[model samples]
Target: MKQIGVALWLLFLPFVLFTAQAQESKPLSVDVLWQIERIGSPQISPSGEYIVAPVTRYDMDTDKGESQLWLFSPDGKTQRPLTAEGLRASQPTFSPDGQALAFISKRHKDDVGQVYILPMNQPGEATRLTSVPTGAYGIKWVGEHIYFISKVWPGKNWDDIAEQVKHEANSHVSAHQWNALPYAQFDHWLDENREAHVFRIPATGGEVQAVTQPLNIQLPRSSQSASSYDIDPSERYIALVSDSLNDGVSPNNDIFLAEIGATEATNMTPQNRGNDYNPMFSPDGQVLAFQRQLITGFYADTSNLVVYDLNKKTEKVLTEDWDRSVRGLVWTANSRGLFGTIDDAATSRVYAINARNGKVKALTGETNFSGLSISNNGILVGTNDSFLHPAQLVKIDTRNGSTTRLDTFNDALLADVELGTYESVTYKGYNGDDIQMWVHYPPGFDKSKKYPLFLLIHGGPHGAISNGFHYRWNAQTFASWGYVTAWHNFHGSSGFGQEFTDSINPDWVTAPYADTIAAANWFAEKDWIDADRMVAGGGSYGGYLSTILLGKEHPFNALLIHAPVYNMYSQMSADFAVHAERFGHYWEKPEIYRDISPHYYADKFNTPALIIHGQKDLRVPVGQSFELFRTLQSRGVDSRLIYYPDENHWILKPNNSVYWYQQVRNWVEQYATPGAQ
Candidate 1:
């Protein structure tokens, strides 16, 4: 029963592609991927009467996109747009009384993103609150104050900060200097002198007060967003997550608690030291809840829920044995329980945790839920999506775990298109574990005839190809070209368990390589698959693994490596270097680097590879892809490098994304002819 590299559910697809050769709807195409409107997270009002969500659309002619806030009733009967067509509004948070909403947007002459308050009950225009020349974001409305996060020069006032910003822009000094770690993030460089801190201004307009600066705790060096800090009900206490270590690789983000006007902050979880973040105070203002992880360098570490009693000065781990990282934290009105989201077996679902006994229960299933917001009455709102469906706003009934669709976003657009069929099947992978793999069959597929296989390796190594729909990497879109596309949640993929995720730790290559190769071999043996006409591809860590395949004997006819980390030494130039924290630098441990780095295997490279990289990709550094492409060319291996100068780690622009899809489609089809034979 523990057959290696073989699928156990081949017999489940007994039907011959389920009505093949019949007149089918149009296949999912690149145009459809671009045309479909993107639905952001939903923010339900405190009163539970209204929900505001952001809907984004792109114009091909202008090569631009705009996001607008849309208003919907809980009953799904009334739907309307709140902002004007051209205005782009995001991060909507309703006021305590539900009469106003605070969001971030730059309208008209605003140079950067500023806080805008839109009245919920009246028809007046959204008014700009902060004119801090440097801009403001991560907005929260609590008790007569509007708190926001802004990056500003320490010990500088608004006018001085404005001058500093302008001087930095106008200065002829094109050089940047950093004395500490984490000098840059994904797409932009982080200014070493400027610190990101939380500040609060009066709700009706008053002088701004720096909340975190006087306490002397800077936010994480790389970046800080809305999840970095939380303010209690009465604004007496503030809980924030800050990194204690200067070493960029090991993220030692610890939770700190301080009274609003206190001189010093207390490090609550300083003893364990791995990573603790997303601190939120309970509704009663007595308990502080946050997530904690025990391992550094391993980002997929299971985060246990920690609850601290503000009054009793006691702490406890609520979800110590749950085996899932809790995120999207929100307190149920009474503070008796909480509803959070987690990734389970490659699917995201909401789960409720009892504060009294630390018990956990699933509240929603199957579909991936995100942007979670809850009302005082237990009404929950979030965006629900799956492999076959795009994100849609929905309200979940907490009692019975049933969902009610609140918005019909893309019904008409998807009605005429035929998405391919897919199934969640398990295959024997590394260490005899039942690895979850998602296989997508082309529309109008005929199982009687053999079809090419398009194998896709997911990045994150920890980031699994979940049940949710994706814009960049879609299995159905690949399958539309007469090939069966599959994604194997290999050993290192998250949502499986702690041990499974940590399988490819310091080595960072062996288990995932074995699992992916096993996945390819598994599909090749299928009666309906053409083993000879197979292609494989991936980005980031996926690209890194594909690079490894190039150095070894593999079944794939070709490979697509995008934004990869090909050389361990050059990877140090990246903002976040992989494995440096765990195995030390390549100079300190040359043997480990030589054994695992893909550049060391260039001598054995023979596979035809399509290398894709974005110049602005700070995570992997585009140089890695360039190195791989050069190696392939020098070895006389058929390879091509596609580079995007304007994109970041992901191809975000509509035109750029469309072009990328077409390029990938052409490359795959040219090497492995599509369609059944």
Candidate 2:
């Protein structure tokens, strides 16, 4: 009996050790599952030998995001953290001498971003420059002083006009008393206050100077207001966009150039309509390059690059025939030409356009290039896939355009992890429109077996599904879980031309819905996709579309809608008051709003839908999701509502984001199965 007992004890020892090792090797917390960090705002030194950027890291244990200043040599051999302390540091701008680095930090615990300067040689404590309540934006070194945009109080002139409008609103309320209380209250607050003005503070901290007065220059009547102004390198002139001449009643924005230290400002862009923004001065200050949007409403028109020659006093179109819009413009150091990133179809590429002849040459081929920076040595391009991976910073040779990867943020994490294969595809829509889409095959996908399909819709009814890596709760996660995912940059999506984007504006909801359905039909035709196990999910405008699709009895087995807008009337009228002007008057466009709203037809919904919304989503109010959830429950539909109390429109908190992902996984497992309950 003693010998038998000893033998049993030895047999149990290996089993206990195996169990301990298994527990140690359990999968990481969901919060750290897809976390990625990269070098943001990489700025090469003036001498082109050193690179300075804010390197961000997401801490899963603390559930907080941290960043610090890091310096790297040109050869990518030596790298070290310049700032050891964990604080949010971003937007590194090097001084002309390259002896010091200037950046913005929120480390003071006041929730205000202040400018801090650090010496390159000494590496001591960062010195705070600006001490104000409103914080600083657009920090640039202009001569000896650092120029930034700060909010300042508008004078009595604007206050008097605001008071007059208030009194008139109050009088109208008194006349109708109970009948017009809501209208009166909204009108009074919306029309009462003047917007924030831009002020220039000294880099070394002194009395700030108001560059643009609120009353003197009026804002465009559009829903989006101007926030910052840019000064030329010469410091002789400042460029701004405002609607002051229109008495705040016109949607038109005109670019104005004002002489520094003078009240006189001249309207450089005299257009009565369209948006002119991102004005950049040439190296020699002889010409200016800016972006101009030529349309109004949702799917209005494509924006193009326009160049203004100060010496010739004329403006010309640089990318006139290029249907894709130019963005992320960086004028070459020599100022002879300009380089920018343009999106065509779904792929983003870098292009260099001749400043004189308007001839464009593709630089970085088909890869999506972002966080672009140019130095005397060459251009630092951050490139990545649109669906799966984080961006990798690479140095491109100017003469040969040979790419060399400097730093990969997720190389170690993605080494053994399998990634979905992406391919560009196209399908015909209901109106015979050629809809372009991208499909993500499941990791280690098998052609012999049918897999679940997830139709991922991008937000922005005006936005596009690009070739760049998506950093949010992306479709790659679904692919990792053995589900095929497809994303379409449907009509009304940007990156194509203005004509394509503007098509869905007035009747914004239906056209994209058709494109999404077309994508689903295309996927169903494929033998590898299981047509019965289809799910639809999205956030923001994408969320709105998901809800709409659920109500339409599409083939989708389940739906995940995040912060969606169900009722167009409530969304445009009350929830998004700041954007009310974009939809025009509710009375004037009542039929248009009613026709596009998904909530009006909620009784038709049959799909099991999971609703997730951030409680503090000021952009798309939580009330929108609440209404949809309540309506779905009333109709006896299989619906679940999950609210993140401390989250905003975008889930940024680490713990909340993890919870959201877990809920999505659970929903997919439960309702997305064959004959699921």
Candidate 3:
């Protein structure tokens, strides 16, 4: 008997060792999260021969991050960095012939990001392509010219613009003057005086020629990027997104089509009432595609794809019958199909839409994919990420939906990190409607033992909690601390359909609040959950929901709210009003504002809460956090307020983000003990 036992132990030694090794792995930490290299969207060559993407690495000591352009081959064999380390490089664009690459970089004595071209076929250093004093961005290379957008004085030349920039820097006056409605965006104040226009220079270097300047039309005042404009393959026409009304307060974005050097442009979508933007010219130069939304005030309105024929001068709405909004669009080589990364259900999937028939077919599944780029041969490259991993550059198979990872970024960092498990679940919510949610269990989770629950409310009121790896409010990170974290796709969450997303407008409290309570009750019924120990919170819209919970009777011991819109009346001071234009102004809809605002229910505030906000949060305004904090204190509830002076709406800086995570962990652990008991 003793000899037989020794022989059996030897047979199972390898299996026992592997299990021990898996059990010894550590859970995800803030430090490990920072250590992972973040990869940007892939920019594939015209023939699908080379792929270049920006890889960013953070230094905890410097409290900064540096990005470098990295090169990858589609066969998954070659991986190397194109740009030098410790320099800023982004906006990678390949030449039409795929012989060279152009990107924005601020190196050496450059004051701002400028266009730099690197030869892909030859062993040569990157050559400075532009010397624009106003700097260059939103770059695209077409035919024999390189196009870029620059904010400049409309009538001033390059030298004059440079002189003006120098004068403004040397001047002591810090005040800004604005005469328009969109005086500020999310974080920074906008200069209403400067106009953003497209400019192009010869590939061999020459005088810059204005593309949109001659038309006397400026890009949208609030924001402009590469997606704001497109140059046709023939280089004969340019399509740009500009405000049709030119009234900043309720500006309607529309597409303007013009000949490359024409003095006047035609408004293509003059009949549409809502916003229309993201003009993309098909490779064949026959069609122009753009996204359109019908509602003026709702930022999260469903965006449908529309295409216009250049020859026929007719327009068609391709995605009018579809329920999902299309984003990150890329035209295929044949120009017969358009590839878009869509927010479908709870995942961000890549879909191929037949441009001719308006039929949509999902090309990727499960995980989130974005930054789609296609080659002339129909090859697709993009970034794929999930809850357990950061984004990796991938070459997606257009036919079978399989992906060949082009870059091995963050693989070593995550090798020893035992990330938690998560799954999609459905529960009875408001009106007994099924609400889909993501529930994450801690590493080494045991069903026999009871664990604490941390319910996370997602913001966006329209932003659905997708399956992409979240950096700011990572559910897996919360689960790593030994608590089961969940993100509920409650009422008003997008991706389910247009009707479900618009269900909670005007009255924001009823459905979402009931769904949240139902989520807690659902968890309470689970045998593995400790019914007495529960916490919930979110940011932006999520923060608003958490504040609502503070005033209502719920199954939560603590709440964590960040950058919340506490008082609806005072939210008028925000950069954008929530329900003013489309629904009605607060004065016009007094009862709706009064009932839905979280501040009105402060009399019932009793739950301990942690309120976090940034001084530069123009979206929700820093005052919202203060109002919630004061109300909690006035009600004699246990509460804490954390303020980030150098941050914006998000804790972007590395050290600040680490400190934020630490503080949140400290706050949550103070009330509800983590781990199973």
Candidates sorted by TM-score, best first: 3, 1, 2
- 151-241, model 3: which lDDT tens digit per residue? 9987788888999999998999999997768888899988887999999988878888999999999999989999999999989999999
Candidates 2 and 3 compared by TM-score, better number = 3
lDDT of each: 0.87, 0.71, 0.92
TM-score of 3: 0.97
Which clashing pairs does model 1 show? none
lDDT of 2 by residue, 1-677 (tens): 99999999899989988777555542222443546666675777766766877778877788888888777766777567877667788778777667788888877564578778888867488888876565666677666667665443456443454455456656746443332112212112232243445566666667767667732774332332222356677888777777534543334566788787777788877763666777788777888888787754222356678888887899998777877788777888778887777776677777787888888887766567766677654555444444555676667665555677766566666554556688888888748898888888765577777888888888877777877766565666667666787888888887777678777767866788888888888989888888888888899889988988876757888998988988776774332332244666658767777777888778798788899987667668778999999998988988999988878778877777878878888898676662211
How many residue pairs clash in each candidate at the backbone level? Answer: 0, 10, 0
TM-score of each: 0.95, 0.85, 0.97
**Per-residue CA lDDT of candidate 1, range 1-677, in tens?**
65532454454344434544234456778778888888898888888988999999988888899999999988999789998899888889888888999999989998889888889897799988888878898888888889999998999999999898888879999998988777889998887888889999987777899999999988887888888999998989999989876456577899999999887999998887678998988888989999888876767889889999998999999888777788777889899999887888898989999987789999887879888899877689888898888898888888867898988878988887887899988988877778899999998788999999999998987988888998899888899888999999999888888888888877777888888888988898889999999999899889999999998878998998889889988888998767766667778888888888999888999999999999899998888888888889999999999999998899998899889989999899989999999
Tell me, by TM-score, which candidate is best: 3
Candidate scoring better on TM-score of 1 and 2:
1
Backbone clash pairs in model 2 (N, Cα, C under 3 Å; residues 3+ apart or in different chains), count: 10
Q: Is candidate 1 or candidate 2 better by lDDT?
A: 1
